[model samples]
Target: MNKKSMSKGIIKDILIVAIGVLAIWIGLQVAFGTQNPFYVVASGSMIPVLQVYDVLIVQGHEPFEDIKVGDVIVFNRPSGQDRVIVHRVASIINDDPKIIRTQGDANPASIPGTDFPITKEEYIGKVAYVIPQIGYVTQILKPPMNYIIIVIVVGIMIVKQISKKKNDKGLNINDLFTKNNSEQTENHFSELDTLEKDKEYSTHVESKPLDEDNSKNNSDKEQK
Candidate 1:
């Protein structure tokens, strides 16, 4: 109802949403085996079909032999390289042990000079989805900007906690008033007892005079 209580509630709500999102992100990583959802095209191997910086969703596939011609696929650029290349399957030149020949859409011929053989294990996955200009944004969000955003969020949470502490101190004023009021009540009761004792002593002092006056009157009547 009060400002302090409202502020605390808002902070709790913000924390809940932030934590929920983080948990979802972690769960997706475990489910998919990747933290990032999209991959950026680094080369022109799939030009005309897919350009540089074009973001595409990569999903697990069965085998390269199962892929059909005209289907866009991504695989390692070259053996022993960590980079990936995206291209279309020109044709299934050989399928005995599952080998395929791939070529870029812009290129004049297929790869490997004479049908570059790609095995079943070489193919990464087919393109699930694509966004034209969003790949550049993903690249930017990858490095320093991600860390910067995390740091800023942590700082805001720390400041909120400090503010909550200050608000708690201000709200404790009511507790102090309650303690003082209880002490005052005890003091007033003690003073009331003292006043009762004083009244009793005054009554005792007047009682002796009345008794003496009564005795004098009785003696005078007896003398007459």
Candidate 2:
């Protein structure tokens, strides 16, 4: 393909891949009933059960009223700076208006505001699944590293396409040369055949006249 068409094809493929990824993200959100269905654990507070950089799949479909003790949950920090926390439910502080207490497994005790008085407003979702250490990929893909990786991948793709085009052009030139050589060889053999046929015809014509002269001399000698 020409340069313009090849570039267009590559762009089209990239767009299709981007759209497919977006569709999958939307589908996951709709299916799990939460905008933030996935979260990566940033701390080792829940160690033994969960580690740093563990990937968590949270499910929002679990009713708030159904949250029980011993269940792990994701929630916004109750007090201080706004941050997401993943902890195990320690106790049900209240039933109505749903208040709960949470504590990290590694911590000796739960901090007052950080762990207790968790209202429904702070609730995000229940920890539905855990994938170990997969969040490290996201960590590495942050900021400058991600940009570098993208540039490297795009550069490699472009180089490969250019090399392939050059190879195709080379093959076409070699095929043209092969075709010309074949035609020249066939014409040379044809000319040689025509020359041989003409030579044979000339020899036959000269022998006929010589034979007629010899026959006339033999008839004169027989008459004498």
Candidate 3:
């Protein structure tokens, strides 16, 4: 209820959420047998089949020897850019040492070094699943936007906390006001009842003296 306790509770909740997220990430990694079990499609190279920002769930457990033509795969670029690429297998150059070629679905032909000479070492995994457009969320979390999002979230939390504190204070004030009104009402009724009792007692006392004087006059008349 106090400021310090509220702050501590918020911090504890944040830690719990963070830990839960980390645990899920680790579980996915172990289940998929890959350090990076997920990858976001950054380019339209695999368009129509794999759009830009499509989320890919890669399974590293797939045997490299099982790869064949037309199968979509994720691999490190053989040459330039030194980045991951998602493309379909154009051909299997060799089976002995496991060499292959890949080409983007949108491209006319496979680029020489960029797509060819894919060895097992460069192979990451097969595309196990595709989640449409979800990678855009990851993209949005990328630099300046992530910072902006954090600020917005923190601001909302602070506003909610302040609002809740104000509501609690308001409720307490209302209870006190109601108690005072109730006490005042009860005291007013008690005073009215006391006044009524006093009025009745005074009327009885005044009527008694008149009755006694009347009795004495009547007795004298009778005697005369």
Candidate 4:
């Protein structure tokens, strides 16, 4: 193909690959429910260990009382608020032989003071994992910074996938532009052979020396 056509083909291939990869990534994120799995460290309730904007992974709890003292649990207060509170369990109260209470790590007041000692009935899931500086993304999506970050991350992943494909294909761009070395060398030798045959034919004509045969030339001129 011509140079211009070949260049267009390469550009089209790149665009197709990029779009396909992006689509597959988005599909996976949606299918696996990864979009809903996020955490926001609202207050300094669990400070000294868990800082603000630190992402925590939460799952549905099996039972409130089943969780241990050291485990960080998410729960709500008696006000029926849907807020997630992360705190280490200080103690478990069996009031009327049917309850458990939890407290915080850095509380100035005792477990029963600020909020009533939390029963197992109010408990949510335990903290699974924490990623620092990720809650800020959850906080501000309209600021354009979140969009910029998402774009950058997606771009990096696309680039890595492209590199992987190139490696797998083993496409040597230089060799593609310049034909195979052995084939080129063979064609050069073929052209040289044709040139040598033309030279040999000219030499044979010169050796005959038609004008040197005088009688033959006189007879040839008379016939002409």
Each candidate structure's TM-score, on Cα atoms with residue i matched to residue i, is: 0.48, 0.62, 0.62, 0.44
Residues 34-94 of candidate 2: C-alpha lDDT, one tens digit per residue: 8876777887566556767776767798887899987889988888637888888999999
Model 2, position 105: C-alpha lDDT score: 62
Q: Number of clashing residue pairs in every model? A: 0, 0, 0, 0
lDDT by residue for model 4 (1-224), tens: 99999999999997876676566545534432344233567766455446677765554433564765455666666445545567666555664543545544444322332234566556556664454556677567864556444434444543554567543321221232235466864564345423322222233333343356744765686699
Candidate 2: lDDT of 55? 68
TM-score of 2: 0.62
- Candidate 4, superposed: residue stretches over 4 Å from native: 1-37, 95-98, 111-115, 143-224
Local error of candidate 3 at 1, Å?
Answer: 1.2
The best-first sequence of candidates by lDDT reads 3, 2, 1, 4
Q: Name model 2 segments beyond 4 Å from true.
A: 143-224
Assess candidate 3 and give its TM-score to the true structure.
0.62
Error of 4 at 195 (Å): 93
| Root-mean-square deviation of Cα positions for candidate 2 versus the true structure, in angstroms | 41.5
